[model samples]
Target chain A: MSDVSSRDRKQSWFYTDIVKEHFFHPKNFMDRDVATDEYDATGKVGSPACGDELRVWLKVDPGSERIREFRWKTFGCGSAIASTSVASVMVTENGGMTLEEARALKPMDIMNRLGGLPARKFHCSVLCDKALRDAINDFYRRAGRFDRIVVEASRVVDLVAKVTDHDIEEAVLEGAHTLEAVQQKTKVGIGNPGVLPAVEDLIRFYREKYFG
Target chain B: MATRHVYLDHAAAAPLDSRVLRSMRPFLEGAGGNPSSFHGDGKEAKDALDDARTRIASLIHARPDEILFTSGGTESDNLAVLGYARANKANGCHLVTSAFEHPAVLESVGHLEKKEGFTATYVSPGRDGIVSADDAIAAVRPDTVLVSVMLANNEIGTIQPVADIGKRLKKLREAGHTKAVLHTDACQGAGAMELDVEKLRVELLTINGGKIYGPKGIGALYAKRGVKLQPLQFGGTQERGIRPGTENVAGAVGLATALEISSEIREAENARLIALRDTLIGGLLARVPKSRLNGHATLRLPNNANLSFLDMEGEALLLYLDAAGIEASTGSACTSAALEPSHVILSLGLPYEVAHGSLRFSLGRATTEADVDYVLDTLPPLVQKLRAISPVRVDEKYYV
Candidate 1:
């Protein structure tokens, strides 16, 4: 409490003016009614329960295999929304990016383009790149290339105890009714309170299905 | 694009009223010397302080000497809870409070329980976020020495049954149980409700100037005569030595002036605010599907409407609303920056995501029908836009 000044704490919660501008006026967010088939591939990352989730869809031209258009949907904070907004613009700025160029796009590139996010919200930038990579993986999967399926270890519930969503589900199946009960069963949220939001979501999800 | 910046976060703090400023100008500029001094300038200052005290005392139906000035509502709250508990410790160390109390009261009660040898009972609110009198009464023990409840919740705007709770405690004392002091943080309610402390049956009541369009630095605690209290601070004997600091003369004048004006105009302003509040609440619920009103529909503060927009993060929605010049609060004003979902909302048995998706729009003197219409016009499209990008499926009956 002594380390952080009240003014600094208040300022840290705000996005840079540029980030706010992009967030308020996002570039190419997907329409809810847009058909799944409209995009060549789709990539998804994070979970709503984790308090951040993003999905990116890309329409690639068959001739050049260059990404012709990008659209996305996200359930996250201001930084995550702004990061996704800027990333979409970065990838589609000069007519389009070749699939390789899109693949090379990094979280730093997105963060730098948006001025910057708060240090605690750096993970929001990371989610933008992960979602894009997942989209590329989807692009490969749709082209009958089973070998290109990059099974990134994205399914993590507790980083400290190395607990996964599957483990949380198993514990819930054994009648873990609350977050505390699930922690007793699988030690999911005990190590990281940061992950408890996600853990709580999974507990509810599983309990609704199994207990109901 | 509308350039008008509509302020609807009045519960966070209201802009100081111009009338209050006019009342405070002489005290700020020419009214010199400390109220404690005995010189000519000091006599002038003392007169101002005495006049302010009388006006403030009259506003709440208390005698002038019962009012003790502190920095603000937080200090007033700290004084009432900590002071009362410590002074009466020989009698008992038991305290009672609601689970949804503001942090000032909560943290003070927390410190007493953790560091001081005190026991506490936290009564949870009913589903509508109102503390039931029965629940509060049931939590009272024979040894309970202090019961602190806010007159109105700052976040959800739910008015507690503080009067009823006070009556019950009055009964308990009449029955020869421990003489527990009933305290209410009337910071948020002083502007919106009737605040006759004697009528409310509260022994100690808190009022801050900021929420009532007075100055920000001044708050007053009304301790009923003969209520034993230990000072939280020590220095020269100001505020009867309970809060020993040089009196903020201009602040006292501003606070008293604000209170006097509030009582004069409360009825008309309350009617106007209640109408605007209903329009905003009704419009949002009607225009935005899946939007749910938080807190008790009828028992809430007239100017407050807390609503949860399904499938959108509150901070994200707040930014969108902020961009459109519609200022609002997500959760309590103090903790909104910390970004944890509101514990007050969660205490109402709301799912966390629903809590996370909530916004509080508190109308004030500046709010107009046009402002309400502008918000109704602006907010629905933004909610639609956010829901489009949201990963949480509204159809997932579990999330709702």
Candidate 2:
């Protein structure tokens, strides 16, 4: 028998303010009228047998990008519930970063806030944060205006560059038919230079690059 | 509006009362002398130890001297089963116990069979999770030295008729066979239920601190004065040489304090818990279809509500509920982590999927009607969500 445990049992691991708050008065968790910018993610933590689950919700803005609102739904330990309680403030107050960034958060910050979690259940804090991020990602995906897109715009400078690239073309080129036929029979649409042939080549390039 | 935090799952462990805490403080801070030492300090410690023994004995209706303080239920069970099996090996090695016994008993029995030359019979409980005294009596061979049964199951909270089993053993002893001893791990029963050893007729009993809201890491084994159990450890003459080394006076005081308070509250707690427990359980059954309650409902503990939701993993539901801010357990906690079906549920012959999804809610002092209501309101949707994702599914063919 280990006569004395390191912790004072009189003040059980459950007596801490955070544990009581989590176990007694959890906050920020009614989502019926929650907004669209909620950084959506899915949190499916705990085992198939242990029966603990946590889902967190965070709403960050694209402009000033501060967490506008935060909430969660937790179904397990007091520490896990407290983790959500503490995490909501952490993510929302810290200028709500990207959902991915929130997903990557660590639990030590929560440990510091809640005093600390029981050594056996440190994962509850991690689950809380992960659930929030998962919900955030899920929320955005549902919104359609979620992923960022980048496309190129055209300019006249590119058109001039294309003309210069054909100046040193091959010696013999075709018109109307094959380049060999043009060379053997007659000069067709070889503009005073080779504008028509260059246009045809440009059309083929465009077709291969995009239209195809 | 405000709500109460439902404190179900008390069978997991309970909260110590102010009275218990008040009784424990002095021992933890002041009563620091070694009971083995023979000074004024030692005398004070010895007196305190005696007081705890007497209190524990009074709760169980056993003799004070029979109480051999150990650490907790696991140690007491090991000392009782392994110690007795090893000591009486010459008499015969056949031991019989139920399949739904706590791991403390089942695992220890396994060690004796594997390490020592002993044969064990694992009796099965019926579909209602009740073991017949006749069945256990029948398993008792002429050579059998011991029979260990739990007063109440820790997970499902099925209260085994250990008193009845003890009576049968007593009858057998009165006729001829006097070698066999009956032991029960009553750590779960000590607090919320009556624990009169004389009424139960148990020769050896297991009582632990943590389960009864005392400090953890302390417990006692009740070894009837003449019941021979081999010593598992050796060091000093402490605890009558049965358990050696320096004693845990603080823990004992705390345990005694907790036990005393628990005894006082037993009746009131039982009534309150049963009423709230029925609501928590009955609500789930009514709201969630295709869910089954495991174990004998009325014969079970006042606070125990073990349920098996069809076509789902208890862990998945647990995680879902966790996110929802409702605390609960899935059968045995460690068994849940293993992702394997619980041995208790499996012993009941449930399908592996149902076994995997078994949940137990043990209500305690902190539990409230609001908490029960919260669970009732929150759980079924979670079950539905999980059923949607279950790999091993149940539809019209399986939902009964």
Candidate 3:
């Protein structure tokens, strides 16, 4: 108790040293607004309404198929900021990773590099990788590599609302744990009894996948 | 460590006053008898407890016996809501409270509704963050046993129209339209606003020691004379059987001293802090782009400045401010264990983005012009830095 009080008085760090380092001084971060033409392709995920949003700008070398420059901007908590910062480093370190290698980089790798994030903050790590994948897809789309572009698997859950299983999963990741909560967030399966089972299954899957 | 440390999270907790500590030292040291005992030592302890109770009661213009001490604000709120509603269940089972009440009150009402077979109505505040008294009173049915609206909001710092609701409830009772009793959680308003219970016309009022520069873990609930409350605990016969357990003599003395000091200095201190609060609020709005205040312009507490910066999360801004030696708080979900933004900010009909980006800086006795100036100088750059990295645009169309 005494040790805790003394540390508090001294202003102890709220996160791990690595997280603090990255959050205080992020790497490969775009600190100023840049012209859209500067980067080859940009990927965006999440929304400010969801309490977190990430955007990554990637310049991939066409010949080597390596990511030449990786820049990101995030509006999120400490964990999100630190996770994106380290993910940027992981993708761009040592002459950068090839397109396939970058695509293979996972949230777990970023979490491991940052030592570990708080349990509740695990979802924050998922965002940067998703944004990075979006950027990768953007690269493919811009290059006219239509066949190479990967689309996330999702099924429509609410026909009227156009809500999908992926939307339910994202809602769960944003702290809507119950079916009703997910519906409140994404309006999934509302007034449509047929898709309740699928919505519930997706909610349970994402809750266990990220939380358990 | 940063060279300048400006503590602005006073609404969360304040540093204990030296005078209060001095008043509490005797009870903490040599005077160790329980107020429940009948021996001489116990008599001395009981005297201290009674004196504290009287002082606390006088602060709110209530009878000495009406002040019931508890562990803190949460417990006091729990006892008032749960105890009162349970005891008065025979009269009615319906409850009414504002949507933005502290979880202590909200959870108790929720428990009554879910676990018990009671119904409740939650009245939301206006865009100005003020709970309308007419709306609250309109929700009070004949079966409504209790109507609770906080004296001031903890997050946005908007001073609620609790007194207006109290007066309306009194009129309803007189007209035999409803049996609902009014309660106000004055935890955030004790030191900054008038506490005369008669003027407020509230049957129950909760005040916490921690927010008033006293020792933590001590609070008092002012129950009107003849108000019936079923005890939440049954360990002892203390607090007239409303709140059981041996009295916290040291805490009681500390709270009394702190309340007395606050009452004496409230006027001058409020004048001083209001200047700092306005400067902080006005300077931030002028310096930062796309920033807006959260609570009512002039109806908020004298020491509160809650603002939302467009296009960035509050937790990130709070961290940067902390790194710059400016301690503060936020309404952002990331700062909360439940991963939900402040209900108070959301109650004002704000969008999730605005709620997530809200920041609160509550001034206190220790705040000064220099501290305010330091924060004014340090915060604009941090907001700019965060905004540069944020994907959301600052344009008005974005919010639309």
Candidate 4:
């Protein structure tokens, strides 16, 4: 118990020096009113209603199949801004990551580059990775490579509303802990009793995954 | 180079006044024994405690013996809501309060509902952030035992119509329609508003030292005569056995001095703060596009200026302001450990995006016009930068 408490005390500061540096002095952020033709593809993720949103503008080299420029903007916390900033650097640094490499980039990689975030802020890192994948998918869609687009693994829980497991996870990350609370946000398993058990399992899984 | 520092989160805590500190110096320097002791030193301590109680009571126009000291606003609120409800359970098990009350009162009432078999109705405030007296009174039933509301909201600083609510409740009692007692957390109002217990007609009133430029960790609850309350803590007879513990002598002294000083200078200071608050609010609205003020325009506390900028999260804005040496607060979920935005902002029927985008700048005694202008000059660029980065469009309306 003492060991855990001492470790927590050492990491009490909300942001690391790197995170602070990135948040205060972000890199490669797109300025307001950038020409639409400047970036080949743009992808956005998260919702303003959830108190976080990220938009990534990607300029990919078609011949090399590598990311040439990665600029982004976010309406989120310090951790979200810093994570996106650092992730932008990670993908575009040293001749930039290939499309495949960028797609394989995980939230852990961004967190590792950030020297780790608070347990609650782990979800913020997840947003940037998802947004980067979305940008990659957008690039592929624009290139008419429909087969190259990688869809996220999400099961539809609410058939009528098409609320997916990803929606439930996002709801949980937004502080909906209980079944009723999660239902309020996503409207999952309400009138669809057959999916109730699955929704419960997903809520438990998400609660442990992000919170623990 | 040293950055220019400007403090604007006075709603969180005010800097302790040196005069109040001087008043508490004797107690801190070991001038007397505990008030509970029977020795000569103890008698001196008791006298000092009595003096503090008298001065504090006089500030609110209550009898000296009606004042009960506790650890702080939380404890006083807990004692009033929990204590009063439990003691009068035989009378009624129902309570009424506003949806946007401080967690101290809300949690206590919640505890009663969850664990103690009590029922409660939480009346939501209007979009203007004022809890209508009619709505509050309408929620009170014959079985309602207590009603808790705040004198002034700590977030948006909208003043509640507790006096009007209290008068209606009194009328109900006179007509034998209900037996409910009125309570108001006046911690935020103690520094600015005239807190006459007679005019407010609150049976239980809570005032904290921290908000009035006094010391922290000390608060008093004014319980009208003949009001029944069960003790939250068990101990020897102290605070009439309702709040039994060793007295915080220095804290009491400091709180009394602070309240006295605040009462003396409130009118002039309020006028000055109103002008500055208006300048800050008006300047921000003019300079920053798609910004709207939160809470009532003219009915809010003189020092509070809460505004929401579109398409940007408040925590990120606060961080940029902090880097620029401007201290403020936010209603963003990211700022709190609970990951929930400000309940006060949400209680106004605003959307989550608006709540997430809210910022509060509460000025205090040492605030100057230059400080307000500094914020005016600093905040616009920061908001623009954040908005430029935000995915939410400037032309889109997040809330209807």
Candidate 5:
């Protein structure tokens, strides 16, 4: 169901000119050559046959690892596009090393930044989190600066968050295998990827009730 | 009329025809009487009710005496399944049905299990949404008392191999399983597909009148003569006492009239609506990015276009379309607010992501190419807007 934006939709082509001056258009990038500390997260959300995909493309600096740039191309609906835009820009402006620096960034944060997207479109920001991490990794990988890649608290939290039996030995081994590698080692056949919540809860239950 | 509203949910209910209205007008006014009363008006109502029963019986190829008027498909389904199973519990306590059947049949089966102590073996249709009659027959146990597979599905619109089921039931009967009553909820098949009680080889058949351009709250269950079903409720000696209360004369007349018209014009109408429906559905796929069509396309109803717009919740899509003045439904109307998606869609084994984004546009007598075109012109951009803010729009690499 392709169509208009909320108040974003112009009453007429005459109203289109007014909308453009306020919001970004279907035109060029929003400040493609932006200031330092831009968020670089890329999200490709949907499939043409089934649904949409988004890629959050954000760039974090190697040394400071602060976000430097953010941009993306979205394929699904206007809500997805708007979500990506808000996330990319907010991460760029607020991203840094301090906990408070990126504190303002979240799905709701992204939504609110764009004068709020439809509640259904909140799922669009899943890519925002991943893109932010990938961008930081990409920046470090590009600069050839780091002696070793440091998997952050933010990135590691995606199912690999806990410092458990697996993470303890794996973390000491010095990037022997990626988090995905460890997950495969620990988990059985991949069923629902999102069943991570249930898996995490199960693992926690076993640790606290039995092992602890 | 110069203008028409989109009426695609015919499986849910059809627009009452002018002719059906014409036939029922007298019954609503001058012909009002208890068909059992000893009076001229009573005799007139009785004649009308009998005539309607005969007409319905003729259309479905059943004896008029075997036909029983019901409140609608739900009641007919309940009576045929639970009624038959409970009455014959001494012989067998088990029943069987397909997982793809409408809730009218499935829920009735569930009730039989819960209340009447009847065990139901629900046979699953594979991913293609087609149930092999062989599989249904295989699920039959020695204790199976009835097999109630729907003739056609209200969702995917797949017609079951009903005739094959009937023949198998006959074979089982010959081998001494004669107590197993074969019943089908044919509510979706009345106007969209063929219906013949004998041809389908079932002991009982259920159909709804509103689904075929007749009055609402009217349906019939064809329990073949001597099928031996116990009635669920005590009633006056109406509808041969199987279904009771004052006869709904207007509803009966309307249903009979609708059945005649639908039987006569079904083929031509199917061809026309199918063309227009296909054009609309096909166009939506081409123009809308990330649009997926749900259900078996060719095997589906003439006017159904079920779609899922990924990365967007179906509820949002329905809301946006409402603002755009195009009305439609997401999955079953009964379960829409639950955010659980349609069980019909889920039974196909599609993921929750696909299920949440599902939409069904059922075509009716009034669907037109222009209406579809108008929809085509309007729907895509709404999808684009919703998709923009969606988060899970990314790629994942999987290892085999």
Candidate 6:
């Protein structure tokens, strides 16, 4: 276990050099002591007990609602830290993303930018987009427009396979008819027995509404 | 930054002792014939193997014939658990193990439960990461055939009451209540604690080379006389056909020499490590707020200093420490490939966040007072910087 890492200088067991770089020298990371009044919107996703927690704060131009600056703080592993760091930089680069555009940011987009995370650590990337959406929702929440909040459910459907409800839904929509078919596609509920009922329910709903 | 690297991850892998290397030189540079062959070179190799076995046996106070050599700690643990359990299935079909055993033991027992139809129970350790003798005894049933507990944990370094459990099991065995064999993975115990097999009362014990100051790819299982163990592999009749492969004479020699040396200086080295360990723990707890030790205060390995700095990821701390010329670990080196927090840490009733934030700094023979002082000086600011950037917050400071 311990001697495995000394083999190649280019790669560690779980992280690439780029991922390590972002983890150690993250960009657009805010000091933990930053004032609450410094940002127009803030979002938080995950909990400390879950082993990954991320908070994103945004400075948005009022008329344009364009994110001028983005800063994040993460209480998580290397992937979570690097993913959020890349997300913070991604949103603010090249004249910044609009609030809607930032809200639409996906975890894969951040993972792709960070070069990629290990298969087991792919769930860490989910924190960044969830936190970004949380920040966007926070912006809308603060402006008395609660209806504009884009609900992004980051609840894991399979902790082992790194599957989510969104992934199961995507699999169901792609014409995976049976539980086995959906499981084969997404691997959701394969290792996690507790998520089976929810996965089965989602499969039934999607199958009846779309294929019935 | 210092040019000399301070290695604090001895529990993961210790640097090989020069003496051990010297002991293996003749075997390595010579003919290196197969121990099973009948030629003169083979006889020389066979003699070397026998001598090494005798030396290793003396380290644990076991007979030479009882020690079965294997690939490493993983193989030895696997052989002890799977080999013994499968061989004695008629005695009973139940097995017991702690939840915090190395994956070698945990996974081997898990396989038995899942595929082999053997019933098993995982005894959870207490908050101090110590598996009490009573807890282990409570899990024992009339049909319980085997109970595999570690001598000392690899991650948190909590020294288990293996001998106490063994004593209780011995009573149960004598009373005809159960026919369970007591096994202890003493890989981490070799250099840090006593490995007297009779004193520990363990029927089967596992020890490895790399954890001590020896070569890698070599380990031994001490199966007490009359303890039945089936072959895990089938090939040449090496290691009494239980391990079933041509033995590495050089590796065996190195392991034996290392074990002999480690056993010889264990007490003094343990004393030195304990001082350095306590100083490191005290410094970190005093300087870093919201930090706490992971395992039992006094019952832990003298070389182990496992501490969790709240509000910071252990991987982050490890990287920063590496850049600062200090090498350490977050938890079990085996499980670090996954993002999930250490199961060993979580088994202590700690929350997942606390497990994720834990870091292990195990001292070794090469560790010096200056090294401890350097870490005491380097860690606080790094922790403060990480804490400043951390989103998670805690109010009260924690200590062991």
Task: List each candidate's DockQ score.
Answer: 0.21, 0.02, 0.35, 0.33, 0.05, 0.34
For model 1, residues B1-400, the per-residue Cα lDDT tens digits are 5488998888888899999999999988885689889899999999999999999998889999999999999999999999999999877899999998888899899999999989999999977889999988888888899999999998889999998999988999999886787999999999989899878999999999998999998999999999989998898888888889899999999999999888899899989999999999999999998888999888999999999887877777777777788888674211233334577877887765676677889899988999999999999999888888776774446334
Per-chain TM-score, chain A, candidate 2: 0.51
| Ten residues in sequence with the least summed lDDT for candidate 3 chain A | A1-10
**Tens digit per residue, CA lDDT, model 5, B131-200:** 8899998888778899988876777677688899889988988898555768988888889777888788
Could you give the interface RMSD of candidate 1 in angstroms?
7.3
Candidates by TM-score, descending order:
3, 4, 6, 1, 5, 2
- Model 4 residue runs over 4 Å out of place are A1-13, A33-40, A154-201, A204-212, B394-400
Q: Estimate each model's TM-score.
A: 0.84, 0.66, 0.90, 0.90, 0.68, 0.89
Which 10 consecutive residues of model 5 chain A have the lowest summed lDDT?
A: A1-10
Model 4 C-alpha lDDT versus the unseen true structure = 0.85
| CAPRI rating of model 2 | incorrect
Where is the poorest 10-residue window by lDDT in model 6 chain A? A1-10
- In candidate 3, stretches whose alpha carbon ends up further than 4 angstroms from where it belongs are A1-13, A32-38, A153-212, B397-400
> Which 10 consecutive residues of model 3 chain B have the lowest summed lDDT?
B391-400
The DockQ for candidate 5, computed on C-alphas, is 0.05
lDDT to native, each model: 0.81, 0.67, 0.84, 0.85, 0.64, 0.81
| Top TM-score model | 3
Residues A8-94, model 1: lDDT tens digits:
245435578789787778779987666777789998875544355688899988778788889998876677888898889888888
Clashing pairs in 3: none
Whole-model lDDT, candidate 1? 0.81
The best candidate by lDDT is 4
Superposition TM-score, candidate 4 onto the true structure: 0.90
**How many residue pairs in model 3 have overlapping backbones?**
0
Candidate 1, number of clashes: 0
lDDT at position B186, candidate 3: 93
- Model 2 segments more than 4 A misplaced: A1-212, B1-5, B332-337, B395-400
What is the CAPRI rating of model 3's predicted complex? acceptable
TM-score of 5: 0.68
